[model samples]
Target: MPFSSSSSSSSSSSSPDSKYNLTSAIRAQTQFLTHAYTSHNLVIASYMKNMDNQPPRHEGSTFGHRVIHCDREEADRRLWNDYFSEYPKYSEAMFRRRFRMSRNLFIRIANVVKGHDNYFVQRNDRIGRLGLSTLQKVTAAFRVLAYGIPADEYIQIGESTTIESLKRFCRAIVDVFGERYLRAPDANDVARLLQIGEKRGFLGMLGSLDCMHWTWKNCPTAWAGQYAGRSREPTIILEVVADYDFWIWHAHFGMPGSNTGINVLEGSYLFSNLANGIAPPCHYVIQGQQYHTGYYLADGIYPKWSTLVQTIHEPRGPKKKLFAMMQEACRKDVERAFGVLQSRFAIVKGPTRFWDKCVLHDMMSSCIIMHTMIIEDERDEQADIQGWKEAPTPEVDIARDENIIFQEFLARHRQIKDKEAHYALCNALIEHLWE
Candidate 1:
């Protein structure tokens, strides 16, 4: 530690003490800086390596990452108790109100779509998350359709998942029941419809044809100009044909709201099959004149096509007034169907929240299909309640009426668009009602 005077005197070649000490100090500082720099680089390299090996910032948060695995047998048992049991958690009325289908029908639907809707096993190690039960998924879809609620709030399902469930549900219903419920009339159907029409005093009425407008809540602003009608609000028209039992037989949708009932009728396929000679044989007699074409009771806005029977705007006498009254009353079949459809599924009653036109179309189609299904189901129950029986045949051969003759079904169907037939039929109908 002492100044080494002897050593400095012996080392003359080392140069002056001041310069030598300064040079030594600079070398020490340089070594220290180099060591510090190396340590800093090593730390930074370790951090970069760790970052490279790390997962993405959004990992484990997305749907693909968050796996929901379910035990199939267990889930089935739970759903069976909760929904399908003889003594289920909810009553039949409650089930009907919530899902808009009877418990049995709901179970049938679930069975049909089970394979398509089942979630895959997600975790091999342990149960990662329980995939939503079939009941949960169905109830979620129903809530969206019936209450217009954000299904995300219920069952903690994501909005996207809820939307997917709804899409699948509608698609499945259409696939499973569309043919049976939403079908053209067959021979039996024609017979029943004609029988009902004759009883209602409309000799050849097929059904009522009308148009309903569903407000588009989420309609895009760009299309507002085209969709907005006289109501000055965005709407989509549904051209529907409904019978006496509120069973909708035909539905043509997706027309913009700027059109009238006449516009829809002109473009509709109401008489397409008749025009092509493929319509079912319709036979009826009014005022001793036989006709081969059936007609639909429509409002005054409809065209004077023979298939369309519009009531007179201004009736002159008691007979015309009675005819008008009956026509208007019968025409409300479609209006009632629309009302029941909206009342059953509030999704159609309220403005639709979906933006896609196709989704809206599918939604309406599904609702109509379901409506017909419910009507058919109720009709069976009504038949049971009424204890309807086939009338006993009476003994024939006592009286042979000269006016009785066997008539054959016409091979060539009449064109339903003849205006002359329309007037003739109207006059006959008026005379019949007058007598």
Candidate 2:
């Protein structure tokens, strides 16, 4: 019993010694780990401190530094007072040639924009220096439209600022005049157009329909396939309907150049109203037969719609030849309008530089609105100068019965896709033109 007790006492005393050795070893390992981490952190901090003391190897070139202008203040004064006030540096003719509008029109547009947005207002720069005046900003936008020149050349404004001004100007023009200029024909407009058509020997013609392509120089590489077509270049299509006086009545833009005019026509709003049964009622008599739908003179590419008249393909007979000649000549109205638009706004003449399609659309829309506005203004002035007066009463050939008109409209609607009606109308036109 005494030997067993002595052995137990010796083992219990050795257990404490083993536990103390194990705890001491663990404490030493933990201290070593902490010291190693601290050393690594110190090395990283020292390297960063050394880098902070080193000189920069390359410096970026700063732009928008003040350039010396000897007469900037005088030029500003002249633009603000002389040109804007009663006394001006340029004549009215010069103003029109330079900006494509009269001085009065320019001022009016400027004032309208300045009132709409603060961006058009002249404010102090961050350094408390005066920024560009409204005249300078709007003129910058006009110059871009007029010459298609880079914004940096003609004005002291930065390129970015000039671009913003142009975008804003176009947006403003559209906002202010879009409702009047870009509207669908009302009842009165339809009546006037019909009367004009009758005077031109086309009893029910509305206008000419055509398509134009505006080259896109900055199309994204990813979208190149969609926009680049048989033209071997990127382009955006503009489908237009223009009347005799070069007023653009409809503009459908942003179609990829890969598509044809026929494709554009298929998707256009030209037929939307007709399809929805909301088109303006057009009634006219040709060869004693009445047509309820007005027609547009299109090229060969357009479909055989009842409301479209295309030139005879390679006409052999004298009647067909005459019809072809008249149809083609009339179809040139839309082309002429496109040419005039490009000439007026050189931004449209050259390749478009913007990346966004919406910007290009707004730019085109604004140009067309301005073109129509100018046309109306000049037309009124010419009418006044020539002592032209409005007719007191318009002659109606035959008063159509309401029931008959409704039946005729239904018949026309049924023939929207009828190729036979198209050929019949063409034959009737040829006979009428020949007679």
Candidate 3:
């Protein structure tokens, strides 16, 4: 009975209702297979395709560059006559004022930069017309840096050429002069600085440490809040250690403006050497107690770290007040360095126009390098700089060999962070400065 009744049951199961459900499922599967991508996925695929199809900016922009054939040869002749000639229109004094360096220094820099990059060499463009002369290019770059002017100040140089020249100049300066100028204090330097600090009543002080903010006018919208400081302006922070002279011994740039001195210090490796026992020996006697690390005079915002000396707040007595006065005065060395740097190179003084933080970093580094170069070149003229520049540099190193003592390193690190030492040093300084 079951076998004979199966035909009717089977036929009923295959009726139109069942047939319709099967057909519906098939149609949904077909639609999904045909159009699997959602709008968001489609948008992403199209963007990737576009990016793949387009040439890069640096290469693509040159495809139809409008070559401006200015009187570059005449410009070169005039530049040589005014500066490099035996007899010239501008005197050596004017050269220093305008170039922000001596004539000989500028020539040496130009020659070195030309060797590194042939773009500085006088050459003909595609059509065989003489392009911007080396002097023209260098001068244009200097003018922009010194004055913070738009790139098109010179009729001979187009805006693009001027901008390119300036960028190349910054890169070359950083590459060529960075090592000599941007170096941390070596052993000889440490010794000299220690002696100078002793003379100034700072005993073991390396220099003054401080932070400066450079406004970022073209900060990305997403980063505006992160880069804005107390002034509510988008900016970047620079942490520098500067000596009594405007020589910046150490620099760390590109911190978001919202950061304080502590944040920048965390981001920098300034204390890594001290932590590892590779820092230059900064031995000094304070109240007959021997200390191992040099200290920087920092502001009150910084933490009470042993290596940072902050002025006493609300000093009640003549001794405390005088100590505070002296501490604050010495701490202004970094601030004064910042002022002199900005005064010399107006580009960093004004709001930054470049969007790339790396470019800004390079620009800042190069400016500091050139500033030091100028300082060294004219050290003879700087009355107070005579002693430190002449300090004998013996080849002394903290890490005598590669084998390190982990225990001693840890002990040194602990000493660096010891708040008790910080207080003790402050008291010793108060007494020392009083006498």
Candidate 4:
């Protein structure tokens, strides 16, 4: 009774019975329950928080967990500027003069490549990034032709473009510019080249021909057969014939070195049956075999053919001096052409550093074609020079002199015994006689 009496008095002091009925009392009780539950949850959360604050107990410590803090945007901008400043510049006029082509020519060519609708579909979209003008693109090509630098380096120096963009630009230029510039010599062009050679005292010389080995890097294992014999390095052998003016008359490139020189020569349309129509008359006998006419000039490496003139290795007394002089003079054209080509394109002065042979080949071929175009354009610009006007007569006289020697040799050989008999006599004379 005492406990009941205390409870009734506590309930009356709290609030009126109507003011707090079963529904209201139940709600008040629920509020207290939610608060108690929340407090209990807070205590559990505090316990877990304390556990998490302790160091992880594992096999090893996380000593190398680094937090990178750098200004990424600023670093990227700096790299872009650094790449942009690598190229050298010349006055627009100087560029035009050196290339010997009008600015319009390059612009027209660039527009054609840039406007190619199909190029837009590429995934990486390199063509869109080439910000260079037409003139700049042409100049970049010149850098490749003249400097022989890797296309990436050329583009960097020639245009304010990225290496990747330059690669695309170079490929596009080669496609468009090569078609526009690197034309095969026609009959008329061959005749003109011969005329220029004659003017330069190369008698009966259709073109000043030479062979060079362009060193390659990281050649495929399958291409071991094509490496240069002496160097034991991968290379692409190129045979080119240029005029006295250094305008390329014929180009035979892309043949593997594993192929014989004779085979390569034969495969070249420049040396094949097509040449017979364009080659000039010869004044020298080859292998002691006399032919009616036609000849090419070759170095000691080539096999003697009636269609080729080679300097005699051994001649008696005074004739030796003359032959040496003639050989020296004839070989100079090729040397000069190579020298000029290398001087302008510094990249090809030695072995390429690229790891792919195909890329290297394309780079080299494009440079060569571009160089020829430059020479052709330069020659056209200087067509009226007095040096060329007075050049052919002296060359014709030398041809006559060579013809006289040929006629004399023919007459003497005819006077000897039968052809087989004469051949045996000559072999016997050389076989036993040792210096």
TM-score of every candidate relative to the true structure: 0.75, 0.79, 0.80, 0.55
lDDT of 3 by residue, 1-435 (tens): 998799899889789888899999999998887676676689899999999999764433477655544676676787788788999899999999888999999989989888988999988778788777777888888888888985453436778788889899999999999999998888878988888798889999999999999999999999999999999999999999999887899999999999988889989878887787556766789888898789999999998889999998898999999999999999999999999899999999999898888889888998999999998888755454356544344443466554556667777778877899899999999999898
Of the two candidates 1 and 3, the one with more favorable lDDT, higher being better, is 3
Best by lDDT: 3
Give, for candidate 3, the lowest lDDT window spanning 10 residues.
388-397
Off by over 4 Å in 4: 1-174, 177-181, 258-260, 273-294, 355-358, 380-435
**Cα RMSDs of all predictions?**
13.1, 5.9, 9.4, 18.0
Runs in model 3 deviating more than 4 A are 1-69, 151-155, 381-408
Candidate 1: C-alpha RMSD after superposition: 13.1
Model 1 clash number: 0
Tens-digit lDDT string for candidate 2 (181-207): 998776566777787776666778889
Off by over 4 Å in 1: 1-59, 62-82, 115-128, 151-154, 380-414
Inter-residue clash pairs, candidate 3 = none
Higher-scoring candidate on TM-score, 2 or 4? 2
Which parts of model 2 are misplaced by more than 4 Å?
1-74, 80-82, 151-154, 381-414
| lDDT, candidate 4, 1-435, per-residue tens | 999999999988877666669779889999999999999999999999998999755432355544333342343344334332344254447646554444445445456656652331222225444333333344455445554543333233322233333455557656766765555554444445545544544434565567777776666777766575557777777787765666665667777666656766766776443232223333322345443333355676665554444565766665444654565576667768878777666666776666665566566666666577666555655563334322222122333476775775565334321345433323322322221
For candidate 3, the TM-score is 0.80
Per-candidate clashes come to 0, 0, 0, 11
Local accuracy of candidate 1 as per-residue lDDT tens digits, 1-435: 246877776677566887989999999999999999999999999999998998765435574576543354465466567667888887888778777778777666666766554531122334564466676677677678777785554355567767888888887777777888877776556666877788789998889999989999888999999999999999999999999989888888998999998888778776666664556667889988988788889888776777888898899989999999998999999889889999888888888878999888778888888788778776754431233233333223422443331111122224455678788888888888777
TM-score computed on alpha carbons, candidate 1: 0.75
User: Which of 2 and 3 is ahead in TM-score?
Assistant: 3
State candidate 4's TM-score: 0.55
List the global CA lDDT of all models.
0.77, 0.82, 0.86, 0.54
Shift of residue 234 alpha carbon in model 1, Å:
1.8
